[model samples]
Structures are given as C-alpha cells and as structure tokens.
Target: MAGPPQQAEGSGSAQASGSSTARKTFELNNDVQVADPSDSLFAYSRDEERVLEDAAPWKKDPHYFHTVKISAVALIKMVTHARSGGAYEIMGVMYGKVRDGVFWIMDAAALPVQGTETRVNAGNEAFEYMVNFQTANNEVGKDEMLRGWYHSHPGYGCWLSGIDVNTQMTNQSFNDPYLAVVIDPNRTVSAGKVEIGAFRTFPEGYEAPQTSQYQSIPMDKIEDFGVHANSYYPLKVEIYKTRLDEQLLDLLWNKYWVATLSQSLISSNRAYATSQLADLGAKLHSAPLDASAKLKKKDEGVEDDATPLNQATQDSVRINTELQNGMTAQVIKEKLFNGKLDAEGARKAVLGVL
Candidate 1:
C-alpha cells in the first residue's frame, strides 16, 4: 500500500522540514540550537518572522504544511496529560506560531475537557477559561499564540476518528494553519515510546490522494481506523529544544531514572491490558487462522484492505507482538517489584523492555 503523502522535497520551504524518517517518540537530543545569538535575527524563545498574519498560504494549498516541531516542555506536558487520562480521553490546546509550514509547538496546557465523568462542559466557559489561561501566561511572559489542539485516544491508536475529522474540519475552517494531534497513551506504554500522530482534514469536496500509513491499532478499533483513515493524513512530526532545555532535561534525568525504576506502568494499566485481550479474541473470531486461505469471491473494482489473506497475516503478527510486549511488561513488574528477582537482575531485564 502507498504510504502517507510525503513532504515536497529539495530546498526552499521544503528544506525547513526535518528528516523524512517518522518519529516514534520524543527524546532529548544534543543538537545545535535553532536560534543563533550571533545572527541577531533569532531569539531563544522566538523565531524571526515566524508569524505570517497577512497571507493564508495553506488555504491556497492543502499540502503546504508538512511538519510539526514541538518543544521539550510542550511534548513533556502533552504526554503527561495524555497518560494521566488513563483509559479515558483528555483534550488540550497547544501554544505556538506557524512559520514555513511547520507548527512550532512551544508549550501545551490541558483543557478541562475530557470524554469521561468530571469533564468540564466546553461551552462559553471553555473560551472564558482559555482567555484567563492566556492572561496568566502573558503575566508570566510565556505569551505564545494558539496553533493547534492535542487529545488522547487512550488505546485505540493515533488516527483521526469520524468525530475527530469533523472537529478538525471545523477548526481548519475557522483556524487556518491549525493542527489536530492524537496521542495513544496505552500503546505508548506497551511500545515503550510515544504513540502520536498529527493531522489536518482535507477541504470539503477535495479528493486527497490515496495513501496509507499503518499504526499498530487495537483489533476492535481496526474497522474504525480503516473507515476514517482517508479523511485526513498524518504530518511528519519532529521535536526541538533550546540549549537550556537540554541542560534542564539532563539535570532531571536522575529524578526520572528513580521514578522509572519504581513505577510499574503495566500494573497501573491493567484495565487497558484486559481490554486489549478482549479485542484480540473478538478479532480472532472474525479473522482466518490460516493466513494462506484463498478467497472464494471478491467485489470488483473495490479495494479492501481488511478481510484479505495478507491482512489476516499482518493482523496475526501484530496480535502476537502485542501480547508478547504485554507479557514482557508483566514480567518486568513481577521480577522488579514483586521480589522475584534482585534489583540488578530486574534492571538488566528492563533494558530491552524500555
């Protein structure tokens, strides 16, 4: 299958994009700062001529945008909120400015909105809260503009849902140069990496080129993933940080190390694991155990991604890998926290797990 549409290549605005390789997760890296002090046109916190308020280039061309570079603090905050949501959904808005088709996500703050009990109504009050939030931000001098929104899917996977496509469409209608980001916290834990995707809906009546980028989604949600996969496309996401951001992360690594050693992510997310197994069983009932089975009949001129022999094979591989990863986490918890193994032994086992 063809992959998602790639960024236009070679120089000019395309040169502003990062590596073509997809980012599995955010990691602090030692790279040169984006802004150079000697050059005088850049600030550590701001980019030169970053905001293009006059022209809506993206409106003229849907493919104009290609990448999203989130700051260290922004990504940290997003994943933290996403994980906190656990099995339920949590939503937030991002703070950034657009330049050269990239969303420079500087910071993220959680909204009171969620798809669970205790979710604050996103009424006029939600707008009121955002205004107050921005007021507080301005007071502290972190006055970045809103560029996009982020939400968690919990376990389903990082793809836009029907509701998500409509929401993003409305946002794009009013908020050009906007983005919708999804984070799958449950998969992130199992994969030992951030499960994330950034997307923008196609304009109405616009026939987007057919492309597909596979995500290791839950078996139960595979249909939903397939049906809505074409409504929008994923952006090539990258992360950036200032030199001070790198220094702070290094200083905090010790704290994170201690926490990682003690926390059992699997134990905490047992509900998700149970649901995963249930989904696997449901998928197995509908899938052929024999991947080599030949189809008896097929619809003419209609391409079906699922229900084919190859799809069954791929699904089995994903299912087996999912269960294996879950078992590894369980073992890690047992050996590390349940007194089944010594600390050194457990630590060594965790190296491959993480």
Candidate 2:
C-alpha cells in the first residue's frame, strides 16, 4: 500500500482565509524534551517548520494542532509487526504520553488479531493481553499511557478507508490526542524503506472548503463513504533514537545478516522442535534409570550410600530449587501488589501451605 497523502504546499498557515479564531500555542511541562539538532545520538531530525498551525486546510477548525513523536524502539516494533503480517493487515495499540499538543509514542503492543486483505479484527485473546499490558506498564512515574492505535494497509496505499475513519472518530472522541497510524508493509519491504502515515480526524459536521484539485471517487466505493477518506489531516512523524536503540540496531544488523544466509521459517521451527524433543527424551531416560538404581539399592539393603560427588550434586539441586521457589514467591507478591491477583490467590501462589 502507498503511504498516507502528503500535506499540500501552503497548508501549514494557521490563519485560514477569512477565519476569525486565533491560533493557540501550548507548552508542555513533562520531561519529554525535544532533542537538540546537533545531537548525534538521534537518527531522525524533526521538521521544525511543520507546526500544527500549518495543518491541512481540512483541519483548520480543530481546537488545537497536534504533533506526533515516535520513539525509535516503538517505530521498530510497529514496522516489525507490520512486516510479520506480510500481505494481511495487522492492528496494535500504542502506549505513550500526550504532553501539551505533542504525543510521544514510547512503546507498542501487537494485539491478537486475524486480518485479511481489507479488515482486521481483534482476536479473542486481545482483551486479556491488553489488561496484562496495562497492569504491567502503568506504574508510578512511568510514561506508559495508552495513546492511540496503528494498523497496516498491506498492498494498498496508506489512505484511511471509510471504516478506518469511523474508528479514528470514536478514538478521538474518547481520547484526546489519539492518533491513527497506517503502514504500508508491502511498500516498506519492496522499497527497502518505511512507508507510513499519521493522521487525526476532524470534528463532526466540519466541512472543508471545496478545492478545484479534488477528484471524485467512483460510485461503487463512494456510497456512505462520505468525506471520511479525505477528512483526516496528516501529522508529521519523527522517530527519535536513543543510545539503546543504536545498540539494538547494531545487534539487529548482525542477526539479519546471519538470517539471510540460512534462515527459513520452517527450518528454524523444525530445529527448535527437535531440540525440545531431545531434551525431553534425555529427562525421560534418566528418570527410569535413577528409579531402577534406587530399587536395586533397596534390595541390597544399602541405605544412605551417597558418594561425596553425589551428595554435592544433591545439595546443589536443592539449593537451585529453593532459589527458584523464592523467585516465584517474589513474582507472586508483585502481582498481588499490582492487583493482578487477589490476596487469597497470591497467598496460595506464594505459600502452598495456605
């Protein structure tokens, strides 16, 4: 799919022709600072000239203009999910903070969904995954707020469909600063570059001034579609990089190079299965041998005949098992504090005696 439509020239002027409302500027109070232009750690640069005041003509009536900044890791995750879906469409939710008019995307989670060429539905496990995600991330002093959603267009270009517009409208109504991002995975892979679009919907009953350059849609696809496909204004996206992201990119390059040489999905899966089976077989074989040895010792009336090496091995196993149990108890306690498990459940989980 092609990416979202680019903003036209002169579209950023805050003052629309004959408009009476004044442009408003907001200052953010959070720690989400804009990276310095001279910073070498960041991979992408923001277009300082493209402010919300200069939004597309269709979005002039919105109360405030919004800018979207995606973290390097978040952008990578989104693109990875899109590429994994291949020709099928995939959907996911974005986690971030909305400071002033700026939306910073900190992370993303791919929802459980089965997608076809045109539509993707959140799968049965999606709700459970979302609940777990919220519980794990929404800690004090954390910037992991639910911000918006994203999906892929596969072979189609990145313009919003009528259904997508409706979804965006509902999201914006409930979540101010909510954004909808569309990625064209096919284009990204083929072009060896990311192809994506960020957009915000206009308010209800808002009409755009007619333009001579606008083209009419064919009758079959236009029914009930209204101006939805054209109503959204594109938001400039900046993928800000961090030091950790640079390290991850270096590791990824090595992994991708290795993958290119001998990696096929089927072969990798088969190897994993074979390794697991071998481990299971080893455990199964050793268990019977140990039992038979114990039976023989009982028959010979040899009690407590462990050698020094065997005693040490037994001690090591017991210590390791106790350490695992302690870690499991700690995890249960944290889950209780996070309200993922009730007190009674936590008690049972941590102390079997309860």
Candidate 3:
C-alpha cells in the first residue's frame, strides 16, 4: 500500500524523470497481466469544434485517457438532471496484444451522472470511477484493446492534478504505460474550441519535464473511435466488426468485452452471466475456420485455477543460497513463469527480502 499523501494541494507539479514526465508502478492482481511493454506512457487529444456541437445543450466538458482497452458503459438514466456538472463512471475492457501494447476504454452504454461522491480522488468520483472501469477490463479477457478514457475537468485549462496523480499511481501499480486525460469545459475564449492535455509517468523516477508538448491526434486514428465531419461532441466509436480490419476488429471485441466484464463484475458480482467466460471459451474452440489455432492461441499459458497467497505462503518458497533466505527479482520471476510461484506469492516473497 502507498503511504498517505505527504501533503495536499489543489494541484502539484510532478517531478518528471527519464524518458517522460509521468512516473508509475503497477502491482498486478491474480486476474491480470501487463498488456504492453512498449506502452509505458499515455497520450490523448480533442477536436474543439466537434465537442462544441455535441455538448451544446448541456455545454458539456470532455476528457480522454489511455488504458488496457476500451469499455462498455450502461446508459445511465438521469435521476435529477444537472445544468452543468455532476459525476459518472466509465466501463471498459483490458486487452493484451500478441507482441505490443494494451488498450483500455468505455463502451456505448456509458453515460454521465448528475450527483454523487465516489471513493476515488478523496471523494472525487471522476478518477476513481475510471479506475474501477479499468479493473473491470481485467476480469473480462486478456485480449481487450486500449482506446483511451474520456471525461471533463471542472473548468479552466486541461492538466493533471494531485488527486489525478494518486489515481494514476494506483493504476501504475497495476501496469505502466497508462495515460491521464483532462478536459476543460470553460474554454469559452474559443467557444467552439476545447483544450485537452495528455500525460504519462516517466519509466524510471519522478522527474520534471524540460518543456511541455501537446500533440493532436486524429479522431479516427484512435483504433475504433472517429468524428463526424459535421459534428463535434457527439462523436462515434465504430462497434461493427465489418467496419474494421482483423486486428482492429479484435481490438474492438477485446475493448468492448473487457469493459462489459469489468462493469458486470463490479456492479453485480458475476451473477448475471457466470457462463460468459465459458461461452467465449467455447466460441474460440468452435470457430469453424481455425478452431485448433484459436484454441491453441487462447488456451496456451492459461491457468484454469488460482491459488490465493499470504506472507507465509510466499516465505515457504525461499531457498537460501549465497544470496539470502529469500530470492531476487530474477529468481521470483523465473518461478512465476515456470509455475513454481504465483504473481502474488512471488511479490510477497520478494517483499520479504526488501
């Protein structure tokens, strides 16, 4: 667990370090694994004019982020409508590529809320809600595609905050290469324009940035999301498999299902569709084209059962040598990959030495 906040501030500067300004660390739970090694950081952008058109009625604010994959969101019914601000949760998936990065996101059913305080961000629901969405992504499948997250900052320019850092670090403990996105709804100076900022932690330590660079990303370039030429706020993320290539389609499925699973697990307790996993497994097994190939790809390295762990279970594996009573990162990793140890067990074993 992380120590309590050293101090509090409306916003604090992140001391950036090697490679990037953002820094993070992830402590994986038994149900998930890092999706991409190359994606050690995150990024996002926005089309101001597009947002202006879509959020016209409510004058909505929007933000975007990157994760293990896109997600599924339930169209939240508005109990009491708010003219401006409220809160909401994002639902999405986590996916792993054969040799690349992971993607995270929310799906069609997602919606904004009117009021509520969440456990995340010191009672700030926004960031914590997103974190839960990511957790859901993991429970679904390992093949989800990352499309990034979207939400609106209260007002002013887009930037990361102290609470955002806390949330990001929480995510980092799960995996590196996650992104933080902030949307500013008060950029009235440009009316039809919106400002967005993307950030990622440095791979090593918390250092400062030399200077900031904001990159503009094409809406369509975001894997499965795109913009309508005539509109801004009401953009669309294509869900039909026929609209994408094989890799992109896989990305869509992984992103969508991960979000679905994540939300289901968190909201209900896997009671709704307990057999969803088995159904997916069956689909992979029975696909007419290359059932064997799919089965091999899907089942390879899969563990049908999980063993929970505690400190003693971890210490039990220690084989004293010239090193010590415990093991090194290498030894622990080797044991994990070789099935000699579980992820949690290995982590505890290593913590023993530290």
Candidate 4:
C-alpha cells in the first residue's frame, strides 16, 4: 500500500507563496492522488498537457470584462414580463453563450418567484425549472448556459440595491462572467423610454472599473440606487436583430404611432374650454358700449340687453364642438391607417357620430 503521494519538486513552495489563502489552506483527503507521480492511475505527457491548456484557456483576471450582447427577442421578452408584473417586481433567468470573450444572450425564462416592490425571491421550483430547461435545450444543440439573471424595479427605476449586490456576488462566485440586468417598467412608460441596465460585479476586495465604454444610461435613474455602484461596472448592451425582428418592429411602430396620435377625450375637452374662455375674454374687452350705459339700460328694465353675451357663449360652444368633431375624425383616420379600425368600421364611426 502506498502512503500519501509526494509533492512535486517546488510544488509546496509555490502553493505556500500563492496569493489565494483558500487554495494555500486546502488539504487533499486520502482518496485523492497527485497525478505527476502516477503512471497508470493518472498520467499526462508534456505535449498532452499543452494541448489541454490550449483547449481550455485560463479565465481573464477578475477585473477584466467583455461586452454583453442581447438578442432583440430576449429584450422584448424581458420588457414584456416586467410590464406584466405591473406594481410588483419580477425576475427571470437569462440563457446564452460566451464566445470570443463576449457574452451573447439569446433567450430568457421567466421565473415564478415571489416578488415585492423592492425584492425578488426564487424558490426550489425556480431551480428545478432552470435545470430542466438547460437540459432540454442542451440536448437539442442549443448549448444554453445559465449566464445571468434579470429583475424589474417597477416605479423605483433601474439600479442595483444592496440586496441586489449581494445576490450578484453570489452568482458571480458560482459562475464567472455572470451579469445582472435591471429594468424599470413604470419609469419606462412614464419617460416614454426604456430604462434598463447591465452590470458586472467585481471580485471580492477589488475595485470595479469605471470607463465610458459602456452605454450611456441616465444618471437620474440611478442616483439613489445604492452605495455599491462603485463595486460593479455597467456594461453596454447591443440588441441583436434579424430580418424577422425588423419586420415585427415595423408593424409595432405603426401601431404605437397611431395610438400616440389619437387625442384623449379629457385633453380635447380641456383645450375646448381654454379656447372658449379666451374668446369670451376678447369679446368682453372689445365691446365699444359703455358699462354705465349698459347698467342704466338694465335698471330701465331692458330684458334683451344681455342677449349678446349669451349669443357669444353659444357661438363659442358650437365652435369648440366642431373642433372636437374634427379631432375625432383625425383619430379615426389614423386608426384606419394603422389597421386598428377597418375602413368599414371607420366609416360607421363617422356616420354614427354625424
């Protein structure tokens, strides 16, 4: 029976001098053997070692990073999921591959997790689903990897809180080159723009890099996020698009434009009221008849003396009504053009109003 395997020459010294305290303190149990001295049990030729090294290159230093690319479909899915959550926060896992030092996100899976205004928690079900998804997709040559995760902030805006930082650190420890994405659906809608961020956390005790290479996100959105911003670096995102995606975007653009062009009933009413008040003021100021004469006539029991004011008020109301009708006609035309309303439906709408 062989005793404990002997360490290679200078191997113990190298281990002692290494900067990683965890690695320096690690002890192999009785079952393991050092491969250098073994012939049949474990062996590697010099050339074979070189080939293995070439096959699996060493990972870059923890501070270094690569760009992240997301597919348009994946982004659309994330945004749709965030929007569906409404006031509550939502989270999901991202699946993709890392190639040529870039993280390319190709797909996403929504997780059925408990969420609140500030936090999200994934249970055992989420892990099971993730494993099943990875297995199923990998079998079909998808080769999907659990690259990162995304969450929504709802009304708060897109930024990582302290809890988010801790979560990201754990993920990074489990999987190097991990990413964190945050989306603010409410802020997106309110600002009429997408509020999203991609970040890579620094290794423990290392300072995060700060450079303008990343995409420009609004500072206002992240002003109050947390103090951990200095511990992570924001990454620029590129949405990959295909021909099919372009066509879909075109259709969506038309629909959105039509909806935006349609005036709301409340706004139309407000505009009409404002215009009527302005016209009434102009008429009252321009009248040449003296106020004293009108009062004297009123005292003399002239019943029809106030008829002009009433006529002016009636005219203002009629003009405002016509303006509102014209606005409605324009909206109908827009809806028909965008296919939201068919030609027959638009015609019916106009005729019914008439």
Most accurate candidate by lDDT = 1
What's model 4's TM-score?
A: 0.54
Better of 1 and 4 by lDDT: 1
**Which window of 10 residues has the lowest lDDT sum in candidate 4?**
33-42
TM-score of each: 0.74, 0.51, 0.28, 0.54
Compose the digit string of candidate 4's lDDT tens values, residues 220-266. Answer: 33334436667777777666655566557555643344345444433
> Considering summed lDDT, which 10 consecutive residues are worst modelled in model 1?
19-28
Show how many residue pairs clash in every candidate, following the order shown: 0, 6, 52, 0
In the range 209-310, model 1's lDDT, one tens digit per residue, is 998654656665666777878778788988777767655665555234445545455566577667766765666665664333423333334445555444
C-alpha lDDT of all candidate models, in order:
0.70, 0.60, 0.31, 0.63
**Candidate numbers, best lDDT first, in rank order:** 1, 4, 2, 3
Higher-TM-score candidate among 2 and 3? 2
Error of 2 at 12 (Å): 49
In angstroms, give how far residue 70 of model 3 lies from its true place.
Answer: 8.4
Residues 119-182 of candidate 3 have per-residue lDDT tens digits of: 1232346446646655676577422333333334422234443444555555544543344444
Ranking by TM-score: 1, 4, 2, 3
- State how far residue 35 of model 3 sits from its true place (Å): 24
lDDT head-to-head 3 vs 4, winner? 4
